[model samples]
Target chain A: MMRVEEKLFQNRYRVDGARAHIEIVDGDVCAVHCQDKPCTFCCPAGCYAMDNGGRVTVITDGCLECGTCRVICGEHRNVRWEYPRGGYGILFKFG
Target chain B: MSEHFDAIVVGAGPAGNSAAYTLAKAGLKVLQIERGEYSGSKNVQGAILYSDALEKIMPDFRDDAPLERHVVEQRMWILDDESYIGGTYRSANFSKPPYNRYTIIRSQFDRWFSKKVRDAGALVVCETTVLDLHMDGRRVVGVRTDRDNGSVYADVVILADGVNSLLARKAGFHGELKPKDVALAVKEIHFLPEQTIEERFSVKGTEGVVIEMAGRITQGMVGTGFLYTNKESVTIGIGCLLSDFKKSGIAPYALLEQMKAHPAIRPLLDGGEMKEYTAHLIPEGGYNAIPAIYGDGWLMVGDAGMFVNAVHREGSNLAMTTGRIAAETIIDLKARGKPMTARHLAAYRKALDGTFVMKDMKKYRDVPAVMDKNRQFFTDYPHLVSQAARTILTVDGVDKKTKERAIRKEFARTRSTLGLFADAFKLWRAFE
Candidate 1:
């Protein structure tokens, strides 16, 4: 019954300040389309969620880099997914 | 700086390590690249190592590998919510030396395997990702890495870049992986005192138990849950097709928490500290989803090649076996002074087809499709069967014949008599 935040807190990451390795290619794609917003549900790290503004929002700092968001986008294919720069992103202590 | 090699291998998971180790031992100038900070920093698994795979790669691997515990018992469970109908296989033979399987932690195991690859004479480079494949016309000639002036040339490149395999996609070796063909699995490891684990799991030194569960835990998704006992920690996780998760709209972590809270599963991790949470994708599409594995001067191995045998929950073995075969193919061609053209590289696929790796995949080739189409197999059957088992086992003064009739009625309520027979036929054919 631990929170996703607490579970992610247990992991280690090398944060890249400039940009997230993954992004919604266009915010309008989520605003006008993607009613289910599967990324919100499938991402294990809880990096994606819907905001009050009727838009999908993401925070990549806690991202586990699982690539779920990349593929879950389905028809939209709006996520411009890339691995974080080498040496960055979640580093599993135990894997 | 750009450099050339006899071959370039991408990714450092089991597949890449096996390929590199074999190529290196064969005296090929191999450069193995990894995107993780270290060899296994990006890898995760429920992590049961089939000793046959590792032993084939390095015969004496047991002498120094960081294995968690050798498995002596395996439990398969069919659960509805609270109770489970389970079958257990325990063997004193499994407990003896030259064990068949062992629990492992990927980060530790990959590091050790990478070390072995290096010792075998391959150049293992970490913290460097292969961004793209450098192609000469249509043939893969080398790889372009993330480093400054990182373009390196080689006669052939082996793509062992795990399940995500962006490089393979970029090169158009295969199109986008259908969500239906892949599964998203999330797992967590809980730390406990070694003695506590030994006593709770009812095992002695280095002996482990594995539990594989299927039923309401996945909430009707086409998937299964597993728990593997490591030396001092327990690894537990559930996986379902991506398409199912998208349709179900269930948060994966929430699913994990709910599964851990299951009455039958909770006590196994009582008082343990959860240290890490990890998520990974498994190629579950069986033989039909396996893409073009070898073409031109390139070949695919491991998850990238979709060599997983989902029926047996075997990916790493297929990964290692595929990697080994690919390496052997390259070694044979090099020794024969042959080029790694698609025709020659066809040997890799041909040779793999002769092994259990491809044979098992072909055997269960229809499983994913059958499993995907049959929702009742996951939801209704588990509930009804468990209910029927309870009905038959509990003596409430009901006549034996009446109990049998009741169970039959319950089963008939779920499916028609013809439909039930057809379901059995579909299952038999799927596994045929």
Candidate 2:
């Protein structure tokens, strides 16, 4: 019945300032969010969520950084991907 | 001037963490470089962590590691369209202290292990991609990263990167991983209340079950499906050889959807909210697919060295074990003030051979090949067996002898006696 304690802080490497931001510009909508967005079903982290108007929004914070969205999102070129600044992404407890 | 350390490890997953932890704990200066923003950021698993290997590294890990459930039961099912024929093993002993295996979420586990590495005094850097190896005439003396001013020298470099290790390939340590040597796996984690998971799996708090399956699920491809009960969620996945998937023209997610809809599987996941879905590549090439493990001033561990034992669904454990062994080898060499040469580092290979990592891999080296070549095992045989079991078990007033004879006919109809015998022989050879 012993439980494993989760790690509190993880060390990461990332750009220092505004340059480290992952930007999604308005005109950069690479693919129109469809009624049945495949990313909603395929993304493991549920990072891609659809709104009432069916506009797909991506929250990169919860991203596991598995690259599934990047590879499977062939319909869109909007995912300007890069690793989060060193020490700031998903940290696995048991992986 | 080049900065030198006792060791530099690339990719801070299970392998890199293990090596770094071991070397640093032994008073050696170890630097671990990870491409992900942080360790475990890019990792995924239907993860069952074997305690034996991890215990070797962190003996009192159970006191600190974030484990979901200790697996007391394991079920292997052979599924047809609607029915399945499978066996289960459950033991109270498995639930006792020092449990054999535990289910884990990779994201949490890798973070914990990495923390242990840092606490052990290894300098760990993340979000740094190693562009290539820095060689001094066949001696790998350092790594050149993508970061500005990123070139760092070391006495040795251990490549613990996972399956898609471009560094090792670019360094000419191995060729491209053929589709046949890898499997594309897709998995989803369905979140349910803890009580629901226990009720569905017939276990109380902290007890867990793992179900492994093969059959019509893969659409006749050489592959398998799995469902593991975590504390409050279920990990369901299906994976097929990349080559088989490519040739069959089936998307990995489609296969996972089909598996979720399976009659025997659907009920367990009923009412569960689907939370996370992810896919990853598993290196299944076994012993033969292992590339050069050690070179001048360099070593390879984990998936980068093709250390997975696919037959047992074990990769992380192998990765950790190989990492530990590699670190041990380096520590021993350094203690003797020996140079990090390929000849000296061959101890890593010898240590691996003496461990279950090499032994288990060697034992099942032929399984993937055999299973790939024999489509019937994944398709026809499961259907026939499930049908026969259904027919025999259903009481339709048919004579018992008739039912028995019908089962025999089903088996014989699908495979000739010679074919059946060959399957048994192949299985034996694969496992022997």
RMSD of each: 1.0, 7.1
Error of 2 at B249 (Å): 0.4
At residue B112, candidate 1 shows an lDDT of: 96
Q: What is the DockQ of each candidate?
A: 0.81, 0.15
Instruction: Write candidate 1's Cα lDDT for A1-95 as tens digits.
Output: 78899998888889989868888889999988878888887899999888887699889999887788888885898999888888888899888
lDDT of 1 by residue, B1-103 (tens): 4778988999999999999999999999999998899999999888999999989989999999999999999999998998899899999999989999999
Residues B259-338 of candidate 2 have per-residue lDDT tens digits of: 88889999988998765556677889898899999999999999888888888899989999999999999999999999
lDDT of each: 0.91, 0.79
Candidate 2: fnat, from 0 to 1? 0.27
**Top candidate, metric lDDT:** 1
Winning candidate number (TM-score): 1
Instruction: For candidate 1, give the DockQ.
Output: 0.81
For model 2, the superposed segments whose C-alpha errors exceed 4 Å read: A1-95
